[model samples]
Target: MSDMPPSQARSRTKVKPMTSKGTGESDTGGVRADVWVWSVRLAKTRSAAATACRAGQVRVNGQRVKPAHTVRAGDEVRLRQGDRERIVVVRHVLRKRVGAPVAVEAYVDNSPPPPPREAVAPAGIRDRGTGRPTKRDRRDMERLRGLAPKPHE
Candidate 1:
């Protein structure tokens, strides 16, 4: 009979190691697509990554993949969240979440830079408690928004 504690015995049990695809060398195997994304800080949560995968918001190597799909190093991953898209080349495969600095090292960002904030026109905002705008006020707001031409005085 073993003298080891039950917890220790369980911990010592051998688990099957996953093999890397293509390469014959045995190392850490491919990580699940959703898990990899979440671990690398691409998504806020593991469930969020899975949700993105299920919603077809995530693509691996240019092909939409399921949450359980495997992802390896050097693969290109594209994630579309709202109006912005993130494109990254997988530099390493990780199954556990890591620090922000370490997470950044896991992927090579290839996404285009976001447009400058100055390029966006500010929305017209009326003062609080102003109630409804008068016809003149409305025309002025429209003109400010470039939706209507200025009226001749």
Candidate 2:
């Protein structure tokens, strides 16, 4: 303060590290379930994560937990969204959301591989601006879906 300029003095002041941008670990020992899910990109939004928790789609260590439940390192977290389920173990407790690469480091994923594409039936698509399907078009669509009987050769 005695010898340095104002700019230099300000620059010398201790700066606090940001909680939002780094290793995903916080000073706190644990993080909330919804916040953790959203931080790791498991849920699209914080509210969505909470909703899933309320619906019993999220489980911690094989037991269903509320959105406010705390998650600690080494705990298993299971999240089910529609037809897919994700199982992960907490490696680090994150307080804020980070980049994809950083988020991946916070948890160890143990989800099963997705089913083969061939096992899923393809849906018939119609071009935009096209009117409703005619009877013949509807029949053809049904046949493609395996919902209508096939004709003899």
Candidate 3:
């Protein structure tokens, strides 16, 4: 019951192959910076990657770039998240998100090792049936954690 010709319908259904800019390569196409980050599991989500790019927390080859910036193999990307910074060198350009193991192969992490965890002193714990802590108990707990001065008397 369709009026359109078969040729017209076929043309409309054609899918374009992904390609990289300035290169005729279809298998290794350049992807957006944010997409690359998210695809490789660097960021939890694509929106997070784009947000990081917008906040100037992402850099490529030492130059700040936008979310739409093109990323190719061999590009060095640096991302800052909270107190830690991650540096990774692109080994492969991936367009779609992949599994953790597969994603690891797409980049070479060049970030410094994380800081060692400090040994924390044991904190005072009240009994399960105990009610709200008294002001004096709170102050004692704070002092134990070096948060407040010890009582004079």
Candidate 4:
């Protein structure tokens, strides 16, 4: 048996930085998807993070996930950015904003790029200016525009 100071032994057990590369924290461990989303300037607010979860935009370890899903280093997250989704593995969890690349460093993307195409016009062409919108029409348009998440119940 070898005797060493606990502090010395603990240091050996912990992952450390190398001269050539970062401490591997970004390459090893980091933040959760929702938290990272907030940290990386993905969403405007955390509630938006949760809403993204409910909208089926986030997936973890190959399964769709909830807002509270805990993300650690190496976990993969899939998110719908707009025209396409991004699949990125967690490289680190950062609560603070790093440089854009550093903030993005915590993720890996296997997702394909979106195809370049013209914006498809919305299917239905309902004109609001033709006449004064009825109360129900107003409410429906508001709902479609997401004025309120839940309708009057």
Q: Which number leads on lDDT?
A: 2
| Candidate 1 local lDDT, 13-128, one digit each (tens) | 89975534422223666889999889888899999999999999999998999999999888999999887899999887887777888788888999988779887666668889
The better-scoring model by TM-score among 3 and 4 is 3
lDDT, candidate 3, 79-113, per-residue tens: 99888899999988888787888788888999997
Q: Which structure among the candidates has the greatest TM-score?
A: 2
- Per-residue lDDT tens digits for candidate 4, residues 1-153, read 459988888777866552224422344344456767766656767778778887889888888887777778667788776777877776666655456676666567677866655543323347667887778777777666567467757
In candidate 4, position 19 carries an lDDT of 20
Model 3 TM-score is 0.69
Clashing residue pairs, backbone N/CA/C < 3 A, model 1: none
Worst 10 residues of 2 by lDDT: 16-25
lDDT string for model 2 (1-153, tens) is 378799988898898654544565775568899999999999989999999999999999999999999999999999998898999999888988788998999989999987899987777789988999899888888898899899668
TM-score computed on alpha carbons, candidate 4: 0.53
Please identify model 2 stretches exceeding 4 Å from their true place. Answer: 1-22, 139-153
TM agreement with the true structure for every prediction: 0.71, 0.74, 0.69, 0.53
How good is model 1 by TM-score? Answer: 0.71
Q: By the TM-score metric, which is better: model 1 or model 4?
A: 1
Sort order, TM-score high to low: 2, 1, 3, 4
